[model samples]
Target: MSELNALHDLLKGLGDEVVRSGERIVGRRNADWSGIPAVPPLAVLYPRTTREVSQALSICHAHNQPVAVQGGLSGLAGGGCTQAGDIALSLERMNTIEDIDEIAATMTVQAGVTLQTVQERAHEAGMMFPLDLGARGSCTIGGNLGSNAGGNRVIKYGMARAQVLDLEAVLADGRIVGGVRKMVKNNAGFDLRNLLIGSEGTLGVITRAVLQLQARPGSVATAWCGLADFDRVTALLRLTRNRLATGISAFEVMWPGYYEYVLANVDGLRAPLSARHGCYVLLESVGGDPARHQADFEKVLQDCLEAGIIEDAVVAASDSDAREFWNVRDAPTAFPILMPRLIAFDISFSIADMGRVSQDCVARLGARWPGSTVLVYGHLGDGNLHVIVDIVGASDETVLQVEAMVYGLVEEYAGSVSAEHGIGLKKRGVLGHTRSRADLEAMRAIKLALDPRDILNRGKIFPDELLTRRMND
Candidate 1:
């Protein structure tokens, strides 16, 4: 049968309302937040339930139709973008919080539920779902799982995968695997849940997940500190980790460029510190006692200030004050308007080497693009640093040049090219910079085993030739 005819038959079987074709699918074509050019797909499938999803995928699989899974469409990576001749499978309609077990400390939610929704619900239930990012209001649980997203609290709570107790996914051929098990430890066979969590939808489409929850802390302390240099930043981090231990929930670092840019570009944001410093660190601690924890938090900062480990510090006097501190950290939310042509990199390095690497990256980027604006900040405790280079009207070739320089440094320093963000189409070619040839082969083998026809998110995560050659064989 012709490819067009096969797609028509598949859509017919799924019914009219479940599928959107041609002009109706225009809105679904764009890449998620990466600013990559869009490719309109053949159609878009909106599956309202797991059965509907299975039915849709079954038909597409039979026709050898490629499917691209989409969640909230807030990803920085291009993993969710649909290509020509592909069908976009969006989980937006499957949003439902099925159950929340208070005693078990688990929340069972459909894949389409937003991270903000989950956080609000957990707060209402007097529990906490700790995986949080700047895009939490729009990013979905399924997207988070697909990317194994790490966010502000990863130093304490870990990544999105760490919070998932159980998961349910639909394989490429429309076979449903996994169940919503709430057990903390289950040593059952192959562990498919872990296999699919960070696969970026190349192996399977995540439909639902049972997430682990933690007791909401009764007291929270937040502070912003100014440090003279990277050494003092690391010193403060070490001191807090040793003194505060697990109570220290966040340790975010911002270089001068990032701090100054946000203050100048983003309106209604006030500087956290009175005087400018070489580096800034936003620290937070959560505990059971309000008065005692506040005293301890303040005392630690006081000691650092006295010992000259920190240049200055401001302990949040109230919740509003705390939000004001975070406002600066979350300034990237304004980038779409402030700097639309920004080239952002989410990479990781060892905690000891991160400062030097960040400095070297800024120097190299500045030397290459003298007129560019570079902003650097991230969760320093977790070794994830975000480096954003803004050059208006940069051509495609210029973007490639920027990526090469940044990724070259990543390879030289033995750093990961992608940290929390998955290696979507954007970073697929440079994936070998971090992973070995054997590693790539193993990953491709798994992809082939799960999706022999190369139908599920075909061009994501792996370089094009790796899978194309194997399928041709």
Candidate 2:
């Protein structure tokens, strides 16, 4: 039979409502937040249950059909983007909170449930699901697990993988594996749960998860501090950690470019401090004792100010004030509106090397593209740094050149090419910059073992030549 005939036969059993093709799939053909060009898939599948997902995958697997898994599509990487002739398996209709055990401090939810929904539910139960990001309102739990996402509180609470106690996923050949186990310690065998969490759907499709929750903080203290330079910024971070200990939840840094750009372009965002410094830091601490936490938080900032670790600072007096401070840090959410053609990078370096690396990157990019604007900010407590370069009237070649420069620098510093975002289509070729050849080989071996047909998320993670070779083999 022809390929088209085989695909038709494979999808025949799946209901029409579950399978959308041609014009019906138009809305699914937009690029993810990464802004890569999108290709419409041959069909989009919305499986409501695990059994339906297995059935659809079984037929597709029998016919050697390729499938691309999609979640909320809020990813900064192009992992979820589909290509021509590929089936887009989306988890939209599978959104349902199965159970919440306040006593056990765990929530069982389907992969399609939004992060904000989980957080809100946890809050309603007087608990907290700590994995958070700007895309929480739209990004799904499955995507979070797939990418092993590290968000604002990674320094304290850790990544999405850390929050997940267990998960259930469907393998490439339509075999369902794993279970939503709420146990904290399970040494039964190899850790399949963690292995699938960061596999980015190449190995399996995450269906449901049991997430660990934290007790809700009784009080949160937020402050915006201006520092003379990166040295002062690091000093403040060290001091904050030393004094606040585990109470520190977020320690975000903003260079002048990022801090100034947001206040200028984004509406309703105002400067927290009247005076401008070399860089800015927005730090938050969460504690059970309200008055005591506030006093300790202020004391740390005061000590920093006295020691010249911070030049000027403003402690948020109300929730509205805290939101105002975070608005500046969260301004990147408006990048699509403010600057559509921006080249963004989410990278990491050693805590000690981050300042030097960031400075060198800004200077080098500035010298290379004199007119380009380079904005830098990130979770300094962790090593993640978000850099965005926007050049006016630049060509595609320019974008590639910029990537080469930035990634080359990342390689030079021995830093990660992608800190939180997974190596989707955008960073596939340069993945070797961070990972060694042996690492690549091991990853490829794992992929081949899990998806021998190379039918799951083809042309993702691995370099093109590697994937092409695997397919030919």
Task: Provide the clashing-pair count of each candidate structure.
Answer: 0, 0
lDDT of 2 by residue, 288-398 (tens): 889998999999899999998999999999999999999889888898778888888999999899889889999999999998999999999889999999999989999
lDDT of 1 by residue, 377-456 (tens): 99999999999999878998999999999999999999999999888788899998899999999999999888888889
Instruction: Estimate TM-scores for all models.
Output: 0.96, 0.96
Stretches of candidate 2 off by over 4 Å are: 1-6
What's the lDDT for residue 277 in model 2?
A: 95
- Name the weakest run of 10 consecutive residues (lDDT summed) in model 1: 27-36
For each candidate, the alpha-carbon lDDT, in order, equals 0.89, 0.89
**Clash pairs, model 1 backbone:** none
In model 1, what is the error at residue 387, expressed in angstroms? 0.9
What TM-score does candidate 1 reach?
A: 0.96
